[model samples]
Target chain A: MKPLTTGIAGIALLAVLVLAPLGLPPFAMTLLTEAVILGLFAMSLDLMFGYTRLVSFGHAAAYGLGAYACGWLLLNTGMPMLFAVFAGALLTGIVGLGVGWMCTLATGVSFSMLTLAFAQLLYAISFKWTSVTGGSDGLAGIPRTVGPFGFAALSSKAGFYYFALACLVGGFLACRALVRSPFGAVLRGIRENEAKTTALGYNTRLYKIAVVAVAYGLGGLAGGLYAPFAGFANTELLFWLLSGQVLIMVIVGGAGTLVGPILGAAFFMLMEHQLSAWTEAWALYFGLIFIAFVLFAPEGIWGLATGLATGRFRPASERH
Target chain B: MSTLALLLTQTVNALSQSALLFFLGVGLTLIFGLMRIVNFAHGALYMLGAFVGYSIAAWSGSFWLALAGAPLLVGLFGAGFELTILRRLYRRDAHAFLMVTFGLALVVGEAVRLTWGSDALQVAGPPALSGVVFMLDEPFPVYRLFLVAIGVVVAVAIWQFLERARLGLLIRATSQNADMANALGVDVKMIRSCVFGIGCGLAALGGVLAAPLVTASNGMAATVIIDAFVIVIIGGMGSFLGSLIGALLIGFVQVFGNYYAPDFALAFMYLVMLAVLVMRPGGLLGKEA
Candidate 1:
């Protein structure tokens, strides 16, 4: 019954987001598109980060790789849009496998560093591989292709916005199903106690790899879609900074909870829009807000909302 | 080029680069080791040190004042971070900490831009360290030699401090085994705060020293920190000796990589890190692996 309510709520939220671009200005719609794409990317990061206790600062490497792959395929092979996106996901999966393999050797800080190193490598490659990547200028003019239903000219902001929103919805539903499955239970077990999980005869490494691969694939899909909308793919997307942005979104929304990242992505993008408009030192303000959230809302926005509604906001010590 | 001169020049260049690398890597490694925080803002602190030095040099017309004073001021700023923010964040997950520090980096970087404007600042070396020295019939920059000397001195001082000082002992103990250190009655919290300050101070010094070497821009910290991460990874995290050796190795890679293939230098660093992780996850001298 609870899950059903949550599902209905989620659908309602999606409807609101879909309709938001229409009422708002064009600039707001553009921002909405960016938020949805980033929200999807953040959700992918949270899948591994929140569920498996594996935090990757290089997740953007996969996302950026996906963008590059899609753009590259579109220009070079002129493959179908869906097929190009599929190719991007495949490439991103391969890279994720390589990164995840190295990462499994170390836990905590070492894992983060390894992922970062791998991502930075991608950034460098993108920067230098001018012949293929268009170098620093990035691969621009990625032709808009027909969706499965046929060509509808998605090069416009409105078409891309709907496409992005649909992708976010589809991806979110898939992730929710994956989390509810037995595989996800095993992952949560591993996250709680790796030693105990391993003792239970579960191949923890395989699970970790599987989770990371899925996250990478999804992130890649988001990135690939993003490129054509932005009409470019730059090395900037592969940076640790982008990874940091995603982490903040996940944290601000809530980890381990499904709807948190979507809310987080919206909050962050909107906050940035408002803050940047008010002052150039918006980052400083954002940092302060982030610190406040980390200190006060350890459970995050969704957690806090639920806690308040349930009358569980009182201190545990005071409960006695 | 004469073999003697070329080798001498390369060695000097390596040491200079190593000094900059050590400044960036050691603080990063130490902070990570002690606080269990990645301190993504460490590079920004380094850049802040350089900008401070630049302003001081510009104002007082004394390179000496800038070199000596900027790091101290920056160190104080780092201490402020430990006392106010990082103290509460110590027990959080690495991802949260990373996000917080990353935000801090963004804020600091923007502040730098606001203060210094969007242009690069020109900072020169002291008169005494500005010229070149004849080495094997070739001239090598004296400033580079000074950098080498400073690197060696700082490295040695850190080595002795960690090995000999009571505070250092406490920090090493806390980092190696926090539970055991707590059992032994050491104030783990105090040690971590001090360690964070010292490490950030060292990064600040590195920035001040590097002001003349690289373009002093607000975004300089981002590039420096990334390179620092590569160096720290290669040297093995949490080991002082590992950081020094890693810096030297990376410096050599960068120099030679630039000569051989300029575009590959950054890629080359990542390749080294990947190779190291695959071959030795614990780093070159890391005891953990």
Candidate 2:
């Protein structure tokens, strides 16, 4: 896309998102907030997956950790809301660094499996350590506080929606800028050819670890937001299924594109809501759609849109 | 039970658990060895097998017949899946295959849930195998011993097939180098389908054998798939011997961990996997990365 066109599109979308709550029903607003939080999580996965060329099967670990951390701080210590979220991100980043260090030792499938193992381990801890994590019941009754500078009480639906929207937009811009920087160029190089990048005198492992930490930190931030957004943090938030769901969002939205995952998250959440309301066997239909997407629309919904807009067939590589 | 008796009982339990793990792990490794595709639906197939076993036993009133029939039916379904869907994905990114199989798992799991009402279905062992056997003053279910024996026999049979059989040679060749095998006039596609079927069959067999112990349940796939993946990782991906040793190690760890620290058993198992990867990233018997 042209720079002018992209800029206009971004601003227009931002306007729509900012003003969406005024027109939307209360339930829709709630869904939008949840979608935005999840979109942020998906974007974090995209940092590693779409750009860094890593497939983490355990991305939920960072997300869940952030949520639990934020919930714990709010429930136990009486910390401010924003500070607790920040603390959650910081803790998640550190954990991500450690996990990234170990996971980056293996590439491809092994790396994915290793991440899965670590995530499952965390899940087990959360599920079994009921005294601390509230077990399967999850950490509930997290007190929502006023936004920074006492701007708005996030306990209110519209207030929380706008706060989540702000976070989503800020997070998206930051990720977009990061991916456009020289460091991101190096990360892409590693993705395309790790050995070649290494031979070119780049420290690929360091780049990978750095990217993983950033992505996971962002994922944690999303989780922290999610806890108060939904009024609780459950073990399900940390489950591998969430990781898979976010992955599907990334793939279905369009990997390597910032706007795509957000759209994908919205599409998925809306579809899920609509489908479940229609039928109890919504999973069967969801599975079919997922399979169709994998088979036919491998580039995802955004990819299809871009392809149609450009009037040309740009394979996945050239688009990047 | 005395300490010695308890220890002996746990050992037997570990062996039986090892047998089930081997069933799940070997199939996973075989398909990975040949196709380099991780069949995420293996657990779903296992669950399907148990459900099938339950149905057949309910109809025929013969646990033996269910044992023989369930794996075969599931294996056919797997083969059909491979030919219809998976074959189309072989040329795409490896992740494509993983995602598709994951989708398959979702479909199968939901289908089973809808069909079986999401409740755990019981399948009793055959009357003959329902009896108890005494070992060192500890009474153990004969069914468990049967599982252990079947596991050992299956392991040996697979070992021999891979070593001495022509079909196994073809499978090994294809796994080692599909292009080279194709050039040598071996039917790579056919071999892959067959391997996939066999792998799914093995998992089903494990499920059928395990149903008597754990009952047929929807939740089985989630737990079993993770354990299967751990076993494959520990044994080293794509190595039969690695899978055997990995299964045994995990079985012992789980059994002993449950005995010692029930709360931390799963965590302990993962810790061991992490330690193995730290020491040898390829797994215990996996090929060097």
**Candidate 2 CAPRI category:** medium
Model 1 per-residue lDDT tens digits across residues B1-289: 8877777787778778888999989998898777767788988888888899999999999989998889888888887888888788656665667767877787788788889888988898898888888887787788889999999899999999999998888888999899899998998877776888788889889988988878588878888888898888888888788898899989988877876689798899889988897788888877664
Encode model 2's per-residue lDDT on A1-320: one tens digit a residue.
Answer: 66787788789988998989889998888888999998899988999998988998899998999999999888898777878888998999999999999998888778888898899899989989998899989999998876467755666888778778888889988998999999989989988889999999998999999998999999999999988777798888877778778888888899888788888898899889999999887887888888998888888877887777676656554644
- Model 1 chain B poorest ten-residue lDDT run: B89-98
Q: iRMSD per model?
A: 2.8, 1.4
Native contacts conserved, per model: 0.56, 0.54
- How displaced is residue A150 in candidate 2, in Å? 4.5
Distance from true location, Cα of A2 in model 1, Å:
4.5
User: What is the DockQ score of candidate 2, to 2 decimals?
Assistant: 0.66
Give lDDT: candidate 1, residue B266. Answer: 82
Candidate 1 scores an fnat of 0.56
Best by lDDT: 2
Top of the candidates by TM-score: 2
